[model samples]
Target: MAESNKHLPRLLCLHGGGTSAMIFKIQTRRLQWALRSTFKFVFVDGPFTSGAGPGVLPAFAGCDPYFRWLNPESQTAEQDQRRVRQLLSKVIKDDGGEFVGVLGFSQGARLTAGLLADQEEQNAAEGMPNWKFGVMLCGSFPPLSLSFAKMPSTKPSQGTDEHGETREPDEDEIIHVPSVLVRGTLDPHGEKGRRLVKYFDPETAIAMVFKMGHHLPGAAGDTTSDKGDTQKIVDAILKVYADHLPYEELKAPKTTVMENRNGQLSA
Candidate 1:
């Protein structure tokens, strides 16, 4: 199965704050297994090192040297934004100009939303390719500083007044790319996750709620119910992928999911 997907289109993966690419790869092994036939995943680390994030310990113990995208303790916002922009450039360049999708967890998911929004506002002359789609898992509301970093300010004085606060993104600034938003019913950030959907095109966005906490659907023990939820997510992803393919490519038979008597879904 792995060998068959070696040539599949890639999905660039971003880990949550306080986790490294290695840990995220291990964390999402099951999901990768499910989607192995459709997409290959590329995991990348954040630039800044940090402590472990929520739900990272115990399970990921001994996997030291966690990381974060932004330094909340930093006093200079502009410097932080500069580093983030650099990371964005590096990731896009590393993608080799292919139409890569994205999947992110927690803080990474928030950053994913911000990146899509930024892609929407960036000029074509800038040469930044838009992400094909996004799978945001348990993400919180995007930080305004990051989400609207590249967007032009609507207020006078270059989108900021004497207070130096950047203006909010207009409705047009919201991204329209296909997306699957995974929310955890037990996560404290449920409300924030709901708010994050407002940043994407509602028409192309699909939101799913799992019965777990601040982690992937099947991470908690991988029970039958969890597997069912994960299968649902996989189905949603495959459906969106097929829907976005060019008509000629659609000639290939589309994948379908079936629900068994045990109430489990299978592809």
Candidate 2:
């Protein structure tokens, strides 16, 4: 029986390059009810174009300037965050209560980190969410990390690697929290993404590798593996998040209460 306030957490999900929030319709449903309303999934699209279907939104398709994650374009970061915050204002504003965190996939992950950088500002004359935590999926960040630092107002410069080769900027300064990063062993971005955990709260940043590629397997919200799947990925993550909550039981929600039950949620 679903309780009155048995709603899910307000999760701000960012999409990958050339993608939008619609792609998740098929993937996040499994969590809809089982999460006991503790998972308020919010989907946000990137401000760019990609060949993937469901297509990129108009707002992103025409960006004059852009860098697909790993490139610390702070302007891109702020714009994207502002866009997400605006969209979320409808559902999550008025402090709708229980902002579990922002979850980003691929390029979305990079944006997620940027969003945090925006919120942690000491002089937040700007409106950045004082969020709870963040999750990165198959993504990493670059440095000189200021959410709006690279914005057109004060565009950030590209960085260089140790070898004097102009590389992407350092991503270390972008985040400040206990974050969890998920990657697939077979995923190309695995190693580098895992390192981001160190940049965030080392005590809280955790990484998980699946026997998969860039995306998690599923027709829609299902984790399917030809051999087998570690459906435990989501639960395991929620488990580790047990103690770090900053909100009260009524005001702030804890993910632990939302159990995966038999280790798997049903449609």
Candidate 3:
């Protein structure tokens, strides 16, 4: 796709729980073009196998297997933390272009929040620079609570390494990033979902909600919504990128007129 702004920051799109990277394109396509010519979008599937989510697994359209970070164990925050850390590492490394921030939905939104939190931590460790952009939709926090591990087998599986030592991820680690969290008021998980945003420091965290549901909330076909929705989310992300970009040097794309049977702006 044509990039809107050459200097616009790259926004890595992440998918939510019960979803694959495919769900992102539909909502982001217009926003990608509208956000300035250089702005970029890239979507990533999570790191968990879909066997965990039933029918949702095959939705990857027969691509290679995938992975996700979910509540794997009960009575321990380790499982959630470990999985998020792994995910954060992957997103950073997978960032082929400049990673200004991230955008995600449902389970993806949870990850986006996690990534933003992690980024904030990074900035703090590296001496605080403005980090945190991108967007999230529906769902919130760890998609579902990791504190509620449903599987008796949810504990990290013991697998053999070349040396055969138990190769489970380290627990005690925390992944924190600074970013936005959006939720639909009517979503089953929406109210509690706000907790997702509270995990971040108020100075860094920006939370918003809509009267909508589990999906990205917005007016049926408008560019933005008073309630949380993809367009509003993307706009927030762009504002973050533009804040970093040379406003005068990076020009937003000008509207181009399409010719119908006659050369006229379609009304």
- State each model's C-alpha RMSD to the native: 6.1, 8.2, 12.7
TM-score of 3: 0.57
Evaluate model 1: give its TM-score: 0.79
Q: What C-alpha lDDT values do all the predictions have?
A: 0.71, 0.52, 0.50
Give the number of the best model, judged by lDDT.
Answer: 1
Indicate whether candidate 1 or candidate 2 has the larger TM-score: 1
Candidate 2, residue 68: the lDDT equals: 34
List the candidate 1 regions with Cα displacement exceeding 4 Å. 1-6, 95-97, 123-128, 143-170, 220-225, 247-267
Per-residue lDDT of model 2, residues 35-128, tens digit only: 4445666664444444542223343454323323232344455555455445555545554656667777776776677666656655221434
Question: lDDT, candidate 3, residue 256?
Answer: 23
How do the predictions measure up, each by TM-score? 0.79, 0.62, 0.57
Residue lDDT tens for model 3, 179-225? 45666556676654655555544443445655565555442343334
List runs of model 2 lying over 4 Å from the truth. Answer: 1-6, 31-36, 47-50, 53-91, 94-97, 123-125, 143-146, 150-174, 217-230, 246-267
> Residue 259's C-alpha lDDT in candidate 1?
36
| Residues 1-267, model 1: lDDT tens digits | 655765788787889989989999988887898888778887888878999998888888889899987787987666776676677567767766464677888888977777677666663213345677888888876523343345324334435433343344357767787788887767877667766776777567777766677888767553423656777787777766666788676333344444344434455
